[model samples]
Target: MANPQKPPTAASKSSALASGKLGQIIRLLQRAKGATIDDLTEVTGWQAHSVRGAISGQLRKRHGLAVSATPDASRGLVYRLPKAGGTR
Candidate 1:
């Protein structure tokens, strides 16, 4: 049998959006001014815990995204993307 392909390299994967739950996280970030875990769930139709994983796991761990969450004045938890660079 042929050799199995290695997983995608960091450079290639970093620019590419992760799929499934991860995709939902990226899309929410791209679309919303500041997307919380709740926003991720609303967009992806996933549970809150899963949305949290998508932000903390896929976006932060794999893609090198900088994310922060804090309670808002009215909206409960609010998420910030990239944590640096780019204008909001």
Candidate 2:
């Protein structure tokens, strides 16, 4: 019988997340300006709750992303990933 496939390592998981809607969300968050729920919803065509779930459940809990949410005058709440050196 053929050997079973190896489980995905962190590198593989990250790479896998770099293509679909998950990737799109990450890209938006990685920007200097970050992104808003409206923006994420628009890009992914998902409801607000779904976007929140993906950020909270998938990115933070599952993938261990240090995503941050900050209050903004115009944007309300903005979400972003950390910069290279820090989780800012």
Residue 82, candidate 2: alpha-carbon lDDT? 76
Which residue pairs clash in candidate 1? none
lDDT of model 1 at position 38:
66
Candidate 1 has its poorest 10 consecutive residues by lDDT at: 79-88
For residues 1-88, write the lDDT of model 2, one tens digit per residue.
Answer: 9999998897888789898999999999999999999999999999999999999999999988899999999889999997556643
TM-score of each: 0.66, 0.88
Residue 52 CA displacement from its true place in model 2, Å:
0.3
Residue 78 error for model 1, in Å? Answer: 0.7
Question: Which regions of candidate 2 deviate over 4 angstroms?
Answer: 84-87
Task: Name the best candidate (by TM-score).
Answer: 2
| Candidate 1: tens digits of C-alpha lDDT, residues 7-81 | 988666645665665665765666556787667777789898877876778778966787767688887888867
Q: Candidate 2: deviation at residue 53, Å? A: 0.5
Give the clashing pairs for model 2.
none
